[model samples]
Target: MTRIVNCVKLGVATEGLDEPPFPGDKGMEIFENVSKQAWKDWLGKQTMLINEYKLASFDPKARSFLADERRKFLFEGNNEMPEGYVPPKD
Candidate 1:
């Protein structure tokens, strides 16, 4: 049976992640409160941030920036896009 969480991001009870996405309190918090769909949405936005900013994943500053963005996007609901960002036509 899939785990269900009262997703903080989507304001609905939905399927949860199988394991913590990180390895500490934040990860556990997400595991307990975020839905699979919300997490997937964050992933897509994360990819966009990485690509648009030309962020190097191995860089500590980039990791920190992404962490801040992740919290804002998932919990705070106020993530910002890169300046002048344009979404690709689907």
Candidate 2:
């Protein structure tokens, strides 16, 4: 059976990740409180952040920036789009 968590991002009880998506304490926190769907959503946003800022994944500073942004997005509900980003029209 899938684990269910009272997702902090979705504000509902839903299917949780099998394991922490991240590492260490933050990952454990997410594994305990965030849903699978919310983590997937963050993955998309994280990609956009990486592309928009031209961030190097191997760089420590870039990794730190993404970690901070992830916490803010998941735990604090602060989903700031990249500057001057426009959504594609359907």
Candidate 3:
């Protein structure tokens, strides 16, 4: 059976991640509260941030920035688009 959670991001009871995204307190917190769709949305935003800012994933500063953005997007309901970000043509 799929896990169900009261997702803070979506503000509804929804399907939860099968496992924590990573093994840590924060990951466990997310597994317990965040929905699959929210996590997928974060992945897309994360890719956009990496691409738009030309951030190297292995760089410490880049990782830090992504982490901050992830928290804001997941828990604080902040999904501010990066400046000058243009969506791809459909």
Candidate 4:
């Protein structure tokens, strides 16, 4: 009996039993992926908002203490952003 059982065990081990899907794999993976995407989207929006405000509130040339680059931001030219910009990553 022991010899027969040992052979059965060897066969099963060599054959490799399949496992059922993990209970939490799908939920955990989706949560992690969405969390990562949300963070990237938030950072992109922050950078864009900072640039927009920096331009919208500009005090131009007469404020000689400011740099030339700063002077150019007083008003939007042909390069103005759309009425309301929303990054598509979200």
Best by TM-score: 3
How do all models score by TM-score? 0.94, 0.94, 0.97, 0.25
Worst 10 residues of 2 by lDDT: 80-89
**51: Cα error in model 3, Å:** 0.5
- Best first by lDDT, ranked: 3, 2, 1, 4
Q: Highest lDDT, which number?
A: 3
Q: After aligning candidate 1 to the native by TM-score, how far in Å is the CA of 68 from where it should be?
A: 0.2
Q: For candidate 2, lDDT tens digit of each residue in 11-52?
A: 999999999976898889999999999999999999999988
Q: Residue 50 of candidate 1: its Cα lDDT?
A: 94
Q: Is candidate 1 or candidate 3 better by TM-score?
A: 3
For model 4, residues 4-88, the per-residue Cα lDDT tens digits are 1111212221221122112476433323222332324334543564565553335553224222222222211112343677556
lDDT of 3 by residue, 1-90 (tens): 999999999999999999999999989999999999999999999999999999998899999999999999999999999988899899
Off by over 4 Å in 3: none
Judge candidate 3 against the unseen true structure and give its global Cα lDDT, from 0 to 1.
0.96
Model 4, CA-based lDDT: 0.33
Cα lDDT, model 4, residue 62: 26
Q: 4, model 3: CA deviation in Å?
A: 0.2
Give per-residue CA lDDT, model 1, range 1-90, as digits (tens). 999999989999999999999899999998998999999999999999999999999999999999999999999987678999998999
Instruction: Compute the lDDT of residue 78 as modeled in candidate 3.
Output: 98
